[model samples]
Target chain A: MTDAPAPGRGWVAVVGLGPGDPRYLTPSAAAILAEAEDLIGYFPYVARVPERPGLVRHASDNRVEVERAAHALALAAAGRRVAVVSGGDPGVFAMAAALFEALEAGDPAWRRLTITVEPGITAMLAAAARVGAPLGGDFCAISLSDNLKPWEVVTARLEAVLRAGLVVALYNPISRARPWQLGAALRLAAEHRGSETPVVLARAVGRDDESVRVLPLAEAADAPADMATLVIIGAESTRLIPREGATPYVYTPRSVEAAR
Target chain B: MTDAPAPGRGWVAVVGLGPGDPRYLTPSAAAILAEAEDLIGYFPYVARVPERPGLVRHASDNRVEVERAAHALALAAAGRRVAVVSGGDPGVFAMAAALFEALEAGDPAWRRLTITVEPGITAMLAAAARVGAPLGGDFCAISLSDNLKPWEVVTARLEAVLRAGLVVALYNPISRARPWQLGAALRLAAEHRGSETPVVLARAVGRDDESVRVLPLAEAADAPADMATLVIIGAESTRLIPREGATPYVYTPRSVEAAR
Candidate 1:
C-alpha cells in the first residue's frame, strides 16, 4: 500500500501534538497528520493518534529519537508521506532537531524530500496557561536531563538565569535515572532568588491526569518533578494573588519598571 | 446591553491568535473566541477576528497594553465574556502579562472574576518551524525593545545568552522609534558568535507578506528587522544544510555532545 503513492512528491512533516491535548493542536498540524501515510514517534505519542486503515504507525521506545528520525526520512525518500510526532512543540526538546540531525548526516537523497515542521503548544506554555501566567515576563527554558549535556553546563545556565532575574522553566527536571537533579537545580535557584519566590509544579498539563500546584520556592523542594511535570520558578517580581474561596492566581507583571 | 444580568459569572480569556495566521490558532483559542461577547486588543490583532453582530471589537493603538487590558477586565466584570487577543502566545511577551498587571491593580472585585489564558503558537515557535528547528536544544528568548526596561538590561542578557551558548530568539527587535536597537543587538551577538553562525530573519510570519531569509551572522545585519520580524541566532552546534533546488535547512542538534 505504501508503494501506491505517485500522486505527488513524497514529504516529511515533523509535527508537535501539543501537551497531549487535541484542543491545543494547530489546524495546520491536524491537516498534516490527516494526510500522512506513515507516522513515527515515541510509543506514548504515537498512541495518541487514532488507528486508521491507510496510515501505518511506527512506535519506538524513548531515547531512540535519532533512529526514529532516520526511519521517517527513509520512508519519505521512498515516496511516502511521513509524519514525525512529538508530545510538545517539536522544536523544544523534541523530535524536530533529531530529524534534522538525521537529514544532515544521511544520504544526500534524503535532503531532497520536502520537509516542514508544524508548531504546536509546548508543555511550558500549556502549563503556564493552566495556572495563570507565571511566565508572563522575561523567561528562559532549560532541560535538566544530562544525558546529552554535562551537569556543569546546566548549573552554569541556571546561575546565569537566576542572576539575570528571569523567570525559569525547567523541563525534564527529574527522571527515574536522575532523581536528585531537580533538588540540586532548585538549591542553585534558591541561592539567587528569594525564599518567597513562587514555584509552579504543573504535571501532565492538558492531559486527563493533569495537576497543578503553586508554592513558594522554600516549599517547592517537596513538589513532584517527574518526567511529565514542568517546573516554573518565578522572578523576584512575580506575585501570587489569593482570592476568597478560590485558588490563588500567579503571574509576573509586564513592565520591569512597574515590577520595581 | 452593558447592564444585562449575570448569566452564571463574568469571565475574561486572554487568548493568543498565533503569529497572524488563522491556521496557527489553536482549537482552544478558536473556541474561546467564538464564545467571547467582546474582544479587545491592539489594532492589527483585533482586526484579524471576523466581524460578528454579537462580538464587539475594541481596537486600540500600540503601547497601551495596560489600558487595553483594563478595558477587557471591566467588560468582563460587567457580565461579558471578553477575549483579550494577542498575536503570539499570550504568556510570551504578549497580552497575558498586561492583563495580569491590570488585574492586580484594579478593583478588588476584579479578582473574583474568572480569568484564563489560552496559549497560542508563539512567534519564535512559528519562525523556528519555518526554517528547520534552530531552537531544538536549550534556548532563551529576549525582547529587544527597551521601552519598559533599561538598554543595559538587554545588552547584559545578550552577553549572558552568548556566553552560555544557548540558541537566542529576539522579539520586537526594531520599530520605527527604535531602528538602531536591532543592529546594536546583532553587533553584541556577533562579538560572541562566529561569523559563520546561522541567523534566520522571519518577517510577518504566518501573514500574507510572510518572508523567511536564512543567512550567516555576518550578513544578517543587512536584513530587515522591523517590529514584525523575529531574529533567531543559532548556537555553536547549529548547522545549516544546503540542498539542491531547495532552501537550506538550519537546525541545532539535540545532543550537546555532538555540538562540541
Candidate 2:
C-alpha cells in the first residue's frame, strides 16, 4: 500500500462524485466525504453533495475567478481536510487543472500541502456503459462550450475525430447559446461517419427520468439534447444489441466490420 | 432497485470476480455469492471465489468436455442458486457466452430461471485506470487469442482499430503456445499508431505485485508480456498529462483535430 503522507498539512482530495447516483459512489469516496471538514465546488455540484454536520460547504458561480480557486487551496492550507468535488470524475475535464493553476502561482504556503485526485466514474464511461459499449474503438470527446477556447479550435478537433474514424463523445454539446453548435457538430459527423452510425443520447444517466435513446447520427442531432446529455457516436462496427427486457445496449465487435 | 427474482426454479448469476482483488468486488455481487448454493466455474476462477457453508463448488478443466457446461446448467435447473464465476468481468470474454450456450440446449424447464450478469471491474478498465485514462474515449477490447477464430480475423480487427484510431484494450495478448502473436500485434500497431503512441502494460492488474509499465507502443510490443497482462493502445488524441508529484497519466483530448 502506498503510505499516506504525514498528516496535518491540509490536503485536498479531488473526488469524482460518480454519475449522479449515491449507490454508484465508491465506498472510499463516501468515506472521504464523510470525514472531510469542508467541500468546495460549483454550486450545482455542491448541492448534489450530501449534507453532513461540521462540513463547511463552499459553492461558486459556474465560472469564477482564480481567487476562488485560491480560496480552496487556502482552506486546505489552513489545515482542514477539503474535497474539491466535481460531478463526474474530477481528473477528466474537472478541478485538477484549476487546482494546479492555483498552486502554480508559486505560493510558498500552498506548496507545502499535499493534493491528490481520487478517480470517479467519468460521464463518458457512465454514458457508454448505459448505452451498451458504443465507446468501442477509437473515440474522441469534444465539448461544445467555446467558453474556454476559440470556436475555430473546437471545429478543428471535430474534423480530426472524423478523419481518424474516432467515435465522438460530445460533452457540453448544447447549452443555452450553443444550440447551433450541436447542429453543426452533427453536420461534421455526417461527413465521415455514416448518417446511419448509431448515436446514443444518455440524459441524466443513473438518475430519475434517465433516458438512453439510440438512433442513427442523423436523428440524434435533431433530438432534444441539452447540457446534461452525453452523446456517443459509434463507429461503423458498433451494433444495437436488443436485450429481452432491458434497454438496448450498443456493442462494437472485436472486429471493425462487426461494428457495421 | 431491481427486485431479486425468486430462487425456486433455479437462477444463474454470471459474476465477475474482478482482477484478483477481493476489495474490488461490488457489494451486490458479494451479497449474491453469500446466498448462492453452488458455484460453477473454471478451476482457477472457482479457487478464487470465497468459501462459505452450504455452497458447493464445481470446477472444470479448461479443455473439459462440452457436457460440463450442460451439467452446470442442469444443476442450476434443479433449484440450486448458482453463480458461474469468471475472472475479471464475467460478461467480457468469460462465462456468459458459455453459460448461454449450455442453457440453449437445456430442457425448457431451465428457461424459468433468471440469468443476471453482475458486472465486475474488468481487467481493461482496471488496467486502463491504473495507467491514466487510456480508455478516455472510443475504444475496443479485442482478445488476441486466436484459439477460437483464425489469426486473419484478429489481424483484421487490429487494422480496424488502427485505421479508426480507437484506443484498443488487448486481452489474452500472449500465451505459452502463441508468444509471438503479441509481437505480431505490436508490429501491426507500429504501422498504424504513431511510434510514440502510448501503450500501457498492466500485468496482473489489481493483484498483489501488480506492475504497470507505461511506454511507447513500439517499446511495449516486444516487452515481456504474458497472458496475465492487459495491454492498452492509445488513440491518436491520447497524451501524457503530468500532475504534481505523481506519475504521468494518459489522457485523450476531448477534441481532436480530426473531429473538428
Candidate 3:
C-alpha cells in the first residue's frame, strides 16, 4: 500500500470526499486530510472538512480550479503537506486533472514532491446505488457544461453514447443560466433510445435531500433539475422491477442479446 | 442519507470494497459490513473481510453471482442481516445487478426486506487516480469480455466512443482464453485516436502489485495485460506532462476546442 508520505515530507494529495455525506468518504481520505497542513478546494467542498488546529483552509470561488491547484503544488514544494479536495472521485471531471495541469505549468521544483490522488464515490455511482445497478454493464459519463468544451461536443458525445447503447451519466445537467440544455439532452436521449427506455434524475445524491426518480425519457424532459443533479439515461436493456410498496428497482442485466 | 436498517430489521447490503484496497473502502460500507450477520461474495472478496465473531462468511466460486444473490436475499428474508461484497463499486459490473435480478426473480418476500447498495471506488476510478486523471473529461467504460455481450457490440462501442473523442476505459480487456482481443482493441483504438495519444494500462490497481504505465496506443497493444488489468485509451486531447525523475503525468484537459 502507498502510505501517505511521512509528515514534513511535503506532498500534495488530491482527495475526493465523495458525494456530500461523510459516511461515503474513504478512511484513506480522512487520514490524508488529517495529515494535511492545508486544504484547498472550491468553497463548499473545503468547508466540508471540519476545523482543526494547524490546518488552514484555502477555499476559493468556483472556476478557479487551476489557481487552487497551483497554490496546493506550491505549498508542497515549500515543504508543507496539502490536500486539494473535490466533491467526488477527483479523477472524474474533478480536481486531479486541474492539479496535474497546474503542476505541469508551474515551478519545476513542484514535480519533486510526492503527489497522490485518492478515489472516492462519484455522484453517478452513488446515485446508481440508491436506486439499483443501472450502470451494471457498459456506461459513459459526460459533462453537459459548455464552458470548457463546445456545446456541440456535448451533443455529439451524447448521441454517440446513446447509439452505442451504453447507459449514460450526465454531469452538471443544468447550468442555472441555461435550463433548456437538460430538455435538449432528454430529447436527444429519447431519439436515440427506445420509446420505453428509463431515465434517472438524481438530485443531491447521498445527502439528506437526495431524490432519485426513474421514468420514461419523455417525462424526464420536464423534470426539475439543477447543476447538482446527475441524470442517468439507460440503454436498450435497462429494466425496472416493481415492488409492492417501494419504487421499483432499475438495473441492466449483464447479458445482452447479440444484434443480428 | 438513507441509513442502514436497524439491527433487528433484517436487510441486505450490496457493497463495493474498492479495487482491493482497504483504504478505498467507504465508511458506510465498513459499517454495513460490521453490522451484517452473514457475509456473502466470491471467494477472494469474502476473504477480504476479517473473520468477525458473529459474522458467518459464505465464499463461493466465480460465475455464481445469481446464486449468491439469492442466498443473500433468502437469508435477509429469514431475518438475517447480510452483506454481499464485490471488489469494486457494486453498481458497476458487479453484485448490485445480480442482487436486483435475484430479488426480481426469486421469492416475493425479499421485496419486504430493506435493501441498500453502498457505492465504492471502481477499478477505473482507482486506476485513474494511480496515474493522473486520464478520465478527467468525457469518457466511456466498456467491458472487452464478450461472455455476456456480443463481440461485435464491444467493437461498435469502442469505435463510437473513440469517434466521439471521449476517453475510454476498457474492463476485462483480455480473457485468459482469448488474449488476442487486447491487441485487436489496441489496434482499433489506434485507428480512432491520434498515434501520440496516451494510453494507460493499470494492473492490480490499489493493491500491492499495482503497476501503472502510460504509453502510445501502438505500444500498448503488445503490452502484456489480462482480465485484471484496466486499460484506459486517452482521447485526442489527452496529454503527458514530463517530470524530471518520475514517469510523466497523463491527463485529459478539461477543455476541448470546438470541432469546426
Compared with the true structure, all predictions reach lDDT values of 0.89, 0.69, 0.89
Across A1-260, the per-residue lDDT of candidate 3 in tens digits comes to: 24334544799999999999999999999999999989999988999999998888999998899999999988887778999999989998889999988988888777777998998899999999988899988999999888898889999988899888899999988876777888898899988887778888899988888888888887999888897899999889999988776668889998878876
Indicate the worst ten consecutive residues by lDDT in candidate 3 chain A.
Answer: A1-10
Put down candidate 3 lDDT per residue, B1-260, tens digits, no spaces.
Answer: 23334434788999899999898888899999988889999988999998867788999997889999999998887778999999989998889999998988999777878999999999999888888899999998898888888889899988999999999998888876777888999899898877888999999987888888888987889888877899999988898987676667889889999886
Q: What lDDT, from 0 to 1, does candidate 1 have? A: 0.89
Local accuracy of candidate 2 as per-residue lDDT tens digits, A86-178:
776664566655565566564766766766655555677667655444554435556677766567766666665565455677887888877
What is the C-alpha DockQ of each candidate? Answer: 0.67, 0.15, 0.81
Where is the poorest 10-residue window by lDDT in model 3 chain B?
Answer: B1-10
Ranked candidates, highest DockQ first: 3, 1, 2
lDDT of 1 at A71: 94
Report the C-alpha lDDT of model 2 over B92-146, residue by residue, as the tens digit.
6666545555554567666555666655566776676565456654456677877
- Winning model by TM-score: 1
When 2 and 3 are scored with TM-score, the better candidate is 3
Report the C-alpha displacement of residue A127, candidate 2, in angstroms: 5.3
Looking at candidate 2, what is the lDDT of residue A2?
Answer: 28
- Let me know the DockQ for model 2: 0.15
- Name the lDDT value of residue A23 in candidate 1: 91
